[model samples]
Target chain A: MELFALSDVPEVREGDDLAAIVEDRVDLRADDVLCVASTVVSKADGRTVNLDDVTAGDRARAIAERLEAITGEAKDPRFAQVVLEESNDLVMEAPFILSETRFGHITVNAGIDRSNVPEADLLLLPEDPTGSAERLHEELGVPVVVTDTCGRPFRHGQRGVAIGWAGMPASRDWRGETDRDGRELGVTVESVVDELAAASNLLAGEGDGGTPFVVVREFDFGDHGGSDNLFREYDDDLIRQALQAWEFPG
Target chain B: MELFALSDVPEVREGDDLAAIVEDRVDLRADDVLCVASTVVSKADGRTVNLDDVTAGDRARAIAERLEAITGEAKDPRFAQVVLEESNDLVMEAPFILSETRFGHITVNAGIDRSNVPEADLLLLPEDPTGSAERLHEELGVPVVVTDTCGRPFRHGQRGVAIGWAGMPASRDWRGETDRDGRELGVTVESVVDELAAASNLLAGEGDGGTPFVVVREFDFGDHGGSDNLFREYDDDLIRQALQAWEFPG
Candidate 1:
């Protein structure tokens, strides 16, 4: 499979048609799978926020003060408030906020962006990333994977992950499958959408020279069982469960 | 960037020259990045083990008994012994085995495989994946990323990750970079090797049809600064610290 970024994508604005923008920039193939940065999706969906307009709640202010005391850096309560407003739950409330968004993705700061916004002070991840992807997929008639960059546990730095996807299953299920020796496979679920997002994110780095829209061509999902159960529920996630009873020493 | 899996990789044997195997299969290009799955690398390095050869000690047996009690599944003390022998630290001990391997990768069971071995009963990850990649990089005159599929804290399914990389930096440091509006970029370090491995993993799924090696062509690392730090140290990882202070409620 081949991947290329869409060049010269103008600064996105609220109410802009992402599908039309992509369709105008390139003649997309039927087999193409488009990976979109959530920045543009948020832009089109009016997900940007101005801190001046945000009111910091008691919780946000307390969290910000605690963060400031712990990290020795200036903390913005309005930003914390925005994260709180966008989140369903705060998985980690101190040192840094690890949260679950309304759309069920667990990420830092509710996947909020302090940068990458031209028209607003902050750009929130799409209100519903999977819904955003579905809209694009419906308009473009191809698979759409909405991508984001986030830090993960047990590893340094960050890479791309799929917050939402459409027109394709989120993962390829390898259960009951066998390896070359016909032994049962160890890896049961392969998150193909996340892999696609990571691949596109490699081509679309963050910066002035960044490319937000990437086209992945000729990828075959194969004749394997597919699954859309990409996000784990509260009872199923061990880390989330562990975090519930544990507190940061700070 | 284009990615394609190398076909017809025969069952890897111990003492195999991996570079020679790739060279014989395809005429590789200098610009291509080769992603070799850990299974093949382990096999080539004689990292397989026989269950009969292992002796479960007191610790392994006790741990296995606890796990079986908690999960209500038949647990093997010998398997737990293998995992203990392979691990430097156990981040999670109950309900499951989460460990830090000798080479610093934090994964379940120190990434030992009970499947994917043709001759042995178990397959262990390479002793030093970076060293394995370095040797291949030296022989082939191109980048090599040793890939592994792993589960993370929040996400549901597993995706590809880089356990070891050579001939290129692990991450593209975007420090001091600016967005389109000339604002300092929010994302600083982009883990390019992990992204590359994730891309290759999309094409090389686990099964009888699995392709252990994939070639990624024309992936540009750009003009950004590079860093070789992929795994997190203890002080730098917050989740590790959290895991330290908590125990499984089970």
Candidate 2:
């Protein structure tokens, strides 16, 4: 698939009609999937948090408390420990970044962020990322993704991942299909959207590049929404169940 | 960057020269970065474990013991409980994969595999993944990555990640640089190799038709080593110190 990174000329902010801004920059071809960085969306919404104003310990504690609220369980101290590690202990009063909510969906900022917001106010992830995607789809008639940066475990750095998707399929399951050698495929579902999101993030680094939107014009799935249609529902419970099933035992 | 997935090959067995086999199928350009799925590598090296042969309870206990051995601490039952919840209580045994190794990296199954391995044998991650990458670099005159599928903490599904890298710069630090708008690019260091690896993995899914090797060409790094010199001796003590600092409450 050929992927093109587009720099949306006009700046975007929360309530700025993201779909309209993107539409004005590029033609929304039916075959193209638009990948957007969440940071831009957050910035446009004026989500900004000042780290210098709070103590690191207090920030960590506050983050832990917010996590507890989202997950409906007291935060695990180990998780808090990991978050502290990722922040290098310099995060005094970090907004809760990302976590699996009580309903089981993965989200950014634990749906919380103060950076990019008007001073002293925080903007959480959209009440429903998929719903947000759907709204964009209705407006633009194309697939849309709201993405964010995430630090992976074991890996030394971070990458962009799809936090919410609409009008596109999240995965492409090829199980029961035949390979070139005619072997029945098993257990090989491809998370195509996430991969594309990561690739696009390379061009749209966290800096102020004005390149928050990525257009993927060429893909193997063709014009049909074979896999993209499956992303209609963002089921948090289903995601949680799947995660619960695959987590490694200690 | 250009990425190509190579597929429709024979099942590799123990003692196979994996690099040579892959080289035979695809021409390696000097700047091409080769990403190989750890499953195929482990399978070629005969890393596999059988679940049907052991009881699930025993498997859970074995895994817990193995985790403790690698971390040099007693396994917390609660943590174990979390793992069991994730693994669906189907774990039969722990393969005693690398733990407390020279690099201080501890992972489940020792980065081993039983899923894609031939029905009888279990596959283990290379003894030293980074060392393996280095050797491949010397032989093929290109960067090499030994990667494996890993589950994310809050996200559903798995993605391929670099467990070891050679001959390619792992990180590109763009911090301190200014954007076109003259904004300081702070903390914008990109894990370019990891992002590329994850992208290539999309075409190298875990199925029959999927290719085990992905050759990525056209990756541009200004002055970093192209493929002949990338590996370095990491200070295990320093890593341990860092881990300790992150682990213990100050």
TM-score of each: 0.99, 0.65
Q: Which whole-number lDDT from 0 to 100 does residue B112 have in model 2? A: 42
Could you tell me the TM-score of candidate 1? 0.99
Candidate 1, residues B1-250: lDDT per residue as tens digits? 9999998888889999889989998888878999999999999989989999999999999999999999999999999999999988889898899989999999998998877788989999999999999999999999999999988888788999999999999999999888888898888999999999999998888777658999999999989999999998888887887886678877
Compare the candidates by TM-score and give the number of the best one.
1
lDDT of 2 at A189: 53
lDDT tens digits, residue span A1-250, model 2: 4456675456555567787778777887887778877655665555444444434465456667766766577754434533343331221122334344332344433544433343443444454556667787888888887776665433455567777788767766655665434555333455666777776776666655667787766545422223543221333222223322332211
Cα lDDT computed for each candidate against the true fold: 0.91, 0.56
Query: How would the docking of model 2 be graded?
Result: incorrect
- Show where candidate 2 strays beyond 4 Å: A14-17, A20-31, A43-127, A172-191, A221-250, B44-106, B178-189, B221-250
**Stretches > 4 Å off in candidate 1:** none
DockQ winner among the candidates?
Answer: 1
lDDT of 2: 0.56
List pairs with backbone clashes in candidate 1: none
Residues A33-77 of candidate 1 have per-residue lDDT tens digits of 999999999999998899899999999999999999999999999
